[model samples]
Target: MTTPFVHPYLPNSAPEVRAEMLAAVGAESVEEFYADIPAALRLTGDLDLPEPLVAEADLSRHVRGILGKNRTRLSFLGAGTYHHHVPAVVDEVIGRSEFLTAYAGEPYEDHGRFQALFEYASLLAELLEVEVVNVPTYDSLQATATALSMAVRATGRTRILVASDVRADVLSKVEDFIRPYASLEHVPTVDGIADVAAVTALLGDDVAAVWVSTPSATGAVETAMTQLAEATHAVGGLLVAQTDPIGLGVLTPPAAQGADITCGDIQSLGIHAWFGGGHAGFVGVADDPRLVMEMPHRLFGLASTSVEGEYGFGDVAWDRTAFAHREEGKEWVGTAAALWGIAAGVYLALMGPQGMVELGETLLARTAYARKVLTALPGVSEADGAVHLREFVLHLPRPAAEVVEELRAKEIEAGVVLGEHELLVCVTEMTTQADIDLLARELGAVLGTATDATTHTPVLEEVAR
Candidate 1:
């Protein structure tokens, strides 16, 4: 088998770190770290097995004995972590020499050379239609923190308001990080969307920024940007949007809705399922160049003069001014190489603008179909006629936690419950008709068994003394 490319700081460095760690523990090495007078605590030699290493063919049989015990299942889980269908071309392109190999040997003296990696950030800026772009942070949570920090300082306000229906993970992050210096408020939602009147009532002079999650965690579509943006603008407060990137294909962009700071996870754009935890986000703005001026993460930029050396003439040349500003431009070198190579080069080439648009439409349609199918199941409940983005919530007969465990026992990975009995199910382009049917079937069985058992037993409600 071919050797997979290993990250520099993995098990390779574990052995070296162990040596120093053992010494600090008053021992010579790992063996000495646990070296006591008890011989029973230590093994004398290697495992009692064959002396010589077996051939590759024989080794495969040995490994299959252990791996065959566990069964792999279809996943329905999509609270924040989703399972996306990654194209084969993505893996192929990212594994190329230009991306996989270390370019540390390349001389920094050739600073003027516009490499392909740098061009990647430029293309992202074009896709987002923004003045600047940065793909530096590892995930969306970090990006949110960084964006909030920049917005607060830029507007010089100490209050931040977040929509009540924002992802719980993001809410906890904001509370923990911003609690030290700022006041945070949660604006309630009307029906499934944000309450525009409540937001307007809360808006005041002290408010620094207002954050909103379009197509909220409940999976309801909230096209409240027009009113929300206006409310924020009235008080000199900035509007920040947390959106799903795929939804932008059809829905109005936050920038078009007059948002001052637009940022969200770009994981839907050709990212893999396995990379969910580390998939980063992008922040875009329309009017504020200062938002990108001192961003926490880095971004790449290009240089183009009106005319070559036109600003320089005779003894009053401004050559130094160009270089001075050039060094401060944004760039992310290593991690972004794969995103550029695969998404821009291959995915775009294969699927033109119309194809990408169609993909987004299909995802929305599929989500709608899945929601109807789930709602039609026995002992299941949901909103009557609410439009969903790509996921929806359901109330089940049994406790949400018990239902989740039952689904897992049958080799099915289901969604998480936000409240005591409510679970959110997400359907993406990857969810086939068969996958949806299996989920419906499994859910019906579990709910029926739970319902019958509960009815036969005596009900006891706890009463307060």
Candidate 2:
């Protein structure tokens, strides 16, 4: 006498519809579909799930309420992914139906998509000062892995010397990805920057590449690029540099500094930090055929079509990609973050060379001001003497994780915790002078250095203004 159950969201969950599907699949009941699964491993009872909300309004409200508990106040957390202001135009361009829905396709069928990616590559190459750039990979970690793999194949060597200060997560990813093909040796650093003498000592005939990062994991700029490049080249090894594309406006491009290959993320380029969803990797190299041929991802190029005054964009060196040779390819290639490439292209177009320079100047000023203000606190000091652009490290008297937890209760995301005493702080154009002052004041209060009166005035005045 009881009516059969039917899921409001899943029409196929209706008993009659499920019966029909089971019949079509030559199965008597849903249990028959799990016949291949081992009896011991098979789940015997329904999963412990909450009752489904059948009403659309109820589902929406539930999701919103859960998300509402997350802190939405001032934040300064930037290790790899950053919080930059994404322009409305960039969103509008990428949100178009064709771009939002389309994946990889033929140039003849998806000419607009091909052209957009070609433009993205061209723009990124200019920023990196390299002759060629591939379509974006999954994220910067993948790009770094692929770059190191290329270095190993190019020099026929098995050892890679990585700077000791590289981000822990990024280092782990590279180590795991290159474990089968090569080995990694950590090079020491002084004052948070790579030590030229240390790198020189590590270089040898067996070294395939020297991996370094500008504004390294601790946010220290590597000032010894020229010396490092000479030392690496002396051993016939390549210099592979991972850099932030946003900082290239002011910092010297890796290619100009003698890096054989360059790779990094494009998350700062008009991409929203949707809780770590907005990362895409880029790899660049000079026009050398040997280096270019080793790239595993798709490369889009511009060509003149048969029609006069017409240009077409299509894949360059198609044979080198896994798409053409499958398992025989140099590395396995799969779906790329092509949409983010398009988004980045839109960002670059909006912020021409001048806009980029202005942005870089703003970051430099903000970062220096923040360091000066925060270091004035009682138990806080600069982690090192190295100059930084947008990110810097601070030494806290207390454990960094404990301090971060306390700040979170006040609805302020302090920064990324590096260790017990080290906290890596990042500043972007989006972080206002008032926000910086607020952070400094709260931090001083937390450290028992700031009085109630001093911490309250500047913030009030700035907010009132």
The model with the greatest lDDT is 2
Residues 1-465, candidate 1, lDDT per residue (tens digit)? 023333444554455565576667777644553556588866666678774434666667778977887654577667666666657776686666655564333324323222443444444444455555454355566556656766787788888887638887877776787675577788878777878898989988888888887667787777788788899899988888777666655666677777777676656656665524536666666535566554644433445446775221111112212223465433222343334333433444454457667877887888888888887877788843457877788888779999999888877776777678888888887777667766777777788732223222111122224
lDDT of 2 at 394: 95
Question: Candidate 2: lDDT over CA atoms?
Answer: 0.88
TM-score of each: 0.72, 0.88
Off by over 4 Å in 2: 1-56, 452-465
For model 2, which pairs clash? none
In terms of lDDT, the poorest run of 10 residues in model 1 is 311-320
Best-performing candidate as measured by TM-score:
2
Per-residue C-alpha lDDT of model 2 across residues 229-248, encoded as one tens digit per residue: 88999999999998888978
Q: Report, for every candidate in turn, its global Cα lDDT versus the true structure.
A: 0.64, 0.88
Q: Model 1, residue 368: displacement in angstroms?
A: 0.6
